[model samples]
Target chain A: MIEEKDRTLKEKSLEKAPTGINGLDDITYGGLPKGRTTLVYGSAGSGKTLMAMEFLVKGAQKYGEPGVFMAFEETAEDLAENFASLGFDLDGMESRDRLLVDHVHIDKSEIEETGEYDLEGLFIRLGLAIDSIGAKRVALDTLEVLFSGFQNEAILRSELRRLFRWLKDRGVTAIVTGERGEASLTRYGLEEYVADCVILLDNRMEEQISTRRLRIIKYRGSKHGTNEYPFLIEEDGISVLPITSLSLEHEVSTERISTGISRLDTMLGGQGYYRGTTVLVSGTAGTGKTSFAAQFCKAACERGERCLYFAFEESPDQITRNMKSIGIKLQPYLDSGLMQIHASRPMAYGLEMHLMGMRKILDTFNPDVIVIDPITNLISAGTEIDVKLMLTRLIDYLKLKNITAICTSLVQRESTEGINAQEISSLMDTWINLRFFESNNERNRGISVVKARGMAHSNQIREYMLTNHGIEIRDVYLGPSGGLLMGSSRDIQEAKETAEIAAQSKNAARRKRELESKLKSLDAQITALNSEFEVQKEELDKLSSEEALRSNALAKDRSEMARIRRADLH
Target chain B: MEDAAQNNNGPELVESDTTPDPEFYILRLYVAGQTKKSLTAFANLKEICEEHLGGRYRIEVVDLLENPQLARGDQILAVPTLVRRLPPPIKKIIGDLSNTERVLVGLDLLPVGEANVQK
Candidate 1:
């Protein structure tokens, strides 16, 4: 039994204890060692209490590891009530006795720390608390509160050291949270040094934007994240994102999907483009830029794929109605939540706020395709530098997340105004130019795929038409008359007249050939009739002569030899 | 305990807000050599001081090449360490100050905080 006890103690000395918090372990590289205390220092409203509770809750709930929480700041009832609001069943865990929330009331008025008095009483209480539940994890929340009444730093520091060492000796992984000091990482600098690991949480407010930053100041035996990481505190709990730096090695699907309009997809390679690629359609006003964007979104929605359309120029309702005229029905998809149309003027908010709103919406919806119709409008509200920076961040974010982002830019033909032309072109994976070219005395909107990275696309400027039916691409309209070059009313009129004349000549030639064949057949029939007539006349003459001979014979026989004539007539 | 903390307060030196030390400066120039580059750097710095820091600044030029031992006193490693010791926090800029905008921004003369866009 003695040998077994020593073996167990040796095992306990080497085992590492996990902090059991969702993302905290990842940040700490692994976790704090078992039986070692970690100091969690942060200012008020910095999620100190939440982190402590999460550590304990994860231990008790997930690992089936019992825990002890001694709160010097809040009563057990108060802690339990706070947990109830967060939907954490603290009472249920307490009933199972796998968890214990102990309230240590250390009133400044009654406390006295003398030199001879060792922290044996406090140690005894902690031991009893851990022993009762066989707890492996312990939390002493806000140890700084004990120093509120004490003026001597040396005494407080020694007491903290004793507390941490006692907890370690008891073989329990302890978390001791404290308030941040003005200059030091923690209230009592000694606590940070004595603890096995130290984590600093900062709830900072800059430009009215509240952000929480977590940094691990020190970890004795383990490697940890030393940089400040941004974390989000929501109703559920804290979520830490390390700002995923994406690698270009992630696999992408090369299969093409139709863009609803067969002509549009045909212009973009045979079928369409690979998924998760940004497509930029830039043009001047009234070049069917929005129509082209709407076509892709409509196609995605039709395929039961989710699409998010951000219309900066038009409202969602107006876009829906306008699309209806072009036979692009989006209402059904909107009703099904598969299509989300978000519309707002560019001047409605700042550039960063707009980007943040887009980010929030993206996180919530996670659609397959995202469309930012006319990004120039959104960027025009900011300075060139701000626009470039925001676009860089947004594009980088999209590429990292592998989201297919399409942006339409309205390039004014009269004025060369855009959001940093260099960056706009550089950031886009593909750029499609839509221009109105004069053809046959009429203005024709020409759609051409200028560049598609890693894919082949038709380079010809196909004539595009937007009618009541939908968008259409006419055949490569090329002719020797150069009707496309000389686009005027007279040119169109001449072309139309020329087409009419050509059709008339084709029909006249067909009619003349038919008449010539019929006349030849009629002449052959007339010759055949003449030949038959000649033969019939000969036969008729033969028959008539015979009858004449018979009559003459009969007459001769009657006049001379009646008997011979009668025999000849017979 | 407060007395003990006081005992370990290192050196007891009362610094004034008005009087400037020989090494301290409202304006300062730090150089390492008399090379053409360093001479041009000193000339440019002197011109800036005469223009912007004429009345308010008392320029103190520290040549590290002449007194290398003084480098340790100011914890200097690079050639030029312009310490604004007259002002609190003693802002230091180590360069020839050829890029005016960078010097201004790095010296806190220009507002380049995260919340503020310099451009």
Candidate 2:
């Protein structure tokens, strides 16, 4: 029994009592300080009471430690009925001798005091309740009501101090809840000052959208996360997201996975993305970005791997119908439950809620692959910093879990392709940029690999077409002006080039029927123009290499990291 | 018993201490044990009833220490608490009952005036 209170992993001086709430234990390192009263304060509807109740209920059910819940404001029946929605069988737990709920209702109008008295009635009731269940944990929700219940503040304050002391002496891990005040943590500003550990929950509205956040104010002798983590109150109770979860701890995978499109796969290191790496595809609207995300999901399902697809702009039905037009039949995978498409609007939640919601889905689905179609719409949910912050931790988590992630981003145009992806591009292992190329008054779709971190990928722009079957990658060909030619302009360029090649090398073209060779030989006959083109290509390569350079301004940043991971093998 | 309570010689006396009282007081004194505070509260209440309500009041001492679960019935929290059971609207008074004026107001024996309304 004593060992239960000593579950601290780091030091023996400070013990912990694990509150069975999900994600809360992860942030508090283990749980609240054991055998000591921890104060949780929040405004009305901030979930302070629910958190405290869950703490006691979880202690009773999971840790085999019976608990006494002393609710100052609500009845035992009301508490039981309220928790039933969260799937906690409070009445059953009480019946099984694992829990005891004592409702202490104090209406100043219903009582008469004829003499000087201490809170001995409260003490006796709490003692009997605790002893009845042999409770190892206790929860006093909204204990600040003592200020309102009793008229004499002097004696009530003294008794409160004594009550906390008595609770500690009893050696039961306890949680005390307080109502949030304007200046102090509690309305009376006493519990926060007295408690060993203090946690603050805030549910505030920004732009008419509310988000619940929890923060640890102080943990007397222990280290805790200080960041304001967002939490959601769902059917399963409060789930706090410890966003400070990942920091360069992801293990790298060398195994390759296919990108679904054969030619597109070839463009990306002749295989596809790294097994557990984040792949980002940035393009303008109607540039086949969603199609790429869908293809990624289909490929995962084909390989008998579970995939989860998050569609932001389209509904699940809409996406299924849209993908059907491109000949990507997702209904079979949907029916087989191999591929799960979850669709929601960007305005539905704050950035943290969306991220936490995805984290929850990721845990339950445990998918091998995840696709977020057009993450650019997430900008509606938060600022650029928020989107970047969410993507950083999300990608790191996915990599740590060894799940392949394909995230699509929609930029404004071809000129702003990598620019829109600038905030997220650095985090991706592979960046696939699609373009809506317009030439000769018509637009065509083209794809290119901007960066593939650990693998060598083709830099050539490959024109692709949406056919009756799906996306078809066309032959790689540059126009006479050394630019990407799309639509009928590409066909016109190709036919004109073919005629020029036949006229220049009738015998040489016959000797080598391949197009690449014919073009190469034709360049041989072009005199000084070929020499000038060679010099230009050389300079372009240097400019491109500088961005990927340790030879440039980014080298100093690399040297610092290189110093950290300097163990015999770089 | 003290000069502080004797100071509030208001209309409660004109109705009860001076005239033949008809309102019977059924008071329940909730105490945890025979502690000094509980005993002091009980003694003070007996003297207050003798002086104020005379033979019209009846005091019942319920020790919560002997029956701990009985504390929940009247939502008793403070030790040595007084419950006015016979009154149409029940009221509670907590503490050592040292402040007799406040106890009178709490038990509806004295006019609480704006203080009761404000609370």
Candidate 3:
């Protein structure tokens, strides 16, 4: 017996019940303390009753734990109809003997006490309902009505305490919802009685945008996340986006994958992106950020991998049509179920709800690559810090799942100071910046690799053109003045070079003709000089012959005496 | 005169008469346990009954600690309450029945002159 007492003291054996709400169990570490009452207080339309009902329904459906919901504000039929839209068939659960919904009507004026009274009637009815379904979970929605019915605070307080104790003694996890008070946590300050756990739901509108937030005020005997989480009421039910509470223990991948654009891949160290890493494509409007992301999606689909594209600015059909204009055919992938494009306006929900919705769809689709085209649109839905925190969780979740994510963001023109885009850029593994270079009265697109964490990337900005064949990066055009030129300017420089070369050839041809004419004249003068020399030589020969003839005639007259002259001549 | 003669005979004889015997009073004292408060209340009620009602009243004691369900029938709240159940209009006095005058007033047993003056 002493050992048993010691064990109980050391272990405490406090079990927890899972609420089955997305991200809620993560924040609570499990759920509310089992067999103990938890107070959930909120104002009107703050989703206090809906949360309580979901707890019971999810308990019955998912965890196989039967539940009893005793509603004081709304009827059982009303609750059934309200929750049916969320796909929670409360009536079906009732027919299967898994749930019991009991509505208690309390009218203050109808109750009259002659002498003494306890809430034995309520106790008996609640007990019978619990026993009828063998319920392991119980929810008493809106405990404030009891205070109105019993007009005495003393009796109501004691009865509430007794009710909580009775529920604990019955060994069933119970949820007690109360309306928010002016200053206290509950209308009657019932938070003191529900000592195990207390959760507060707040609904507020800021700047014409409504946001629903939930916080766990206190939890006993267990560690829980104490942060304000945003939740959404959707077709599936309440989904809580627990930002900053998730631990950063996701696995990292080292494999490289394609970015779909081969030239862009070459710019990114010749291999593309590392698997399971975040890539940020930030650019101003009309810079083809979405088209670039679509290229990545196309590559992923061609590899027979699943891709999910979240478009906040355009519809799926619109994106498909727009991408088609750029020669990227996403229709086949969409038809083949390899790609899913989910489009919704950022104003449709708060940042955290969008995160939760993305998480839900991600879990269902289980894609290899995810794209959020222009995450900047989310800036209008929340503050910078809120968007940053949400994106951080989203990136962390994707990395943990070993899924590669490419997020595009639009930077405002004339300003490179987008706080959200800059913050997200710091968290990304690779950052690709796109801009427009205006020259020659036309704007030309340019893409530059700003940062790549673990690999070498090109530092030069490559001019890209979005032609009918898709995005193509042209080679670097170095001008004669040592500046990089693109598009029409490069063409103009090439044309100038051609004209300069043609003029130089024409001058060379004229100089060659002049040189040839001078050479011909010089050749004629040389020949005439040679002929004069020849004529002079001929005249000299003729003069010498005449002289010789005169000498010969003289020699003939003196022939007799010429024997001596001939002998001398011989 | 016949009701007066039956009431003078005995309280049991008044039970058999049953012809609107307004003189005969029936009182029930509800107690939770044999505590000092319950005993004092019982003593006080017995004394008041013998002095004021003489043999014209019948007394019954109910212990709620033994059978708690009986408290609901009369809507008993506090312990040791004296209930005047025999009269057509039932009345109750709570808290150990210490105030005899108030208890008498509550039970409609005051003298005619004082009752008329109080009214």
What is the iRMS for every candidate structure?
26.5, 2.2, 7.3
Better of 2 and 3 by TM-score: 2
The DockQ values of the predictions, listed in order, are 0.01, 0.44, 0.04
Ranking by DockQ: 2, 3, 1
Q: Per-residue CA lDDT of candidate 3, range A1-570, in tens?
A: 999998887565557899998778989998888889999999899989888988998999889999999888788899999999788899999999899887776654433322334465466557767877899999998878888766457866887889899999999999999999988878899998989899999988876667788999999888888888877675578867776456777777889999998998999999999999999898888999999999999999999999999999999999999999999999999999999999999998777578778988999999999999878887678766556666777788799998998989888762345555787787799989888888779887888988898989999988898878788888888877866788899778778889999999999999999999999999999999999999999999999999999999887878757675575554
Error of 1 at B87 (Å): 61
lDDT for each residue of candidate 2 in A1-570, tens digit (9 for 90 to 100): 556655654355577899988788888888988888888889998998899889988898789889999999999999999999778899999899898888989786666554466888889889988998899999998788878877777788888889899999998888888888877668888663465888999988766567678999988888888888877676568877665654686678888999988998898879988899888898888888888888888888999999999989999999889889999989999999998999988888777678778888998999999998877777667655545666776787798899999889888757544565887788888888888777677888888888889888998988998875777889867776788777787788789989998887987766677777878878777866788889999999988897777566576666666778773544
Order of the predicted models by TM-score, top scorer first = 2, 3, 1
Docking quality class, candidate 2: acceptable
Docking class of 3: incorrect
- TM-scores, chain B, all models: 0.65, 0.74, 0.76
Range of the 10 consecutive residues with the lowest summed lDDT in candidate 3 chain A: A108-117
lDDT of 1 by residue, A12-69 (tens): 6546666655456677755677778888889898888888887788788878789988
Which candidate number has the best TM-score? 2
Position A187, candidate 3: lDDT: 80
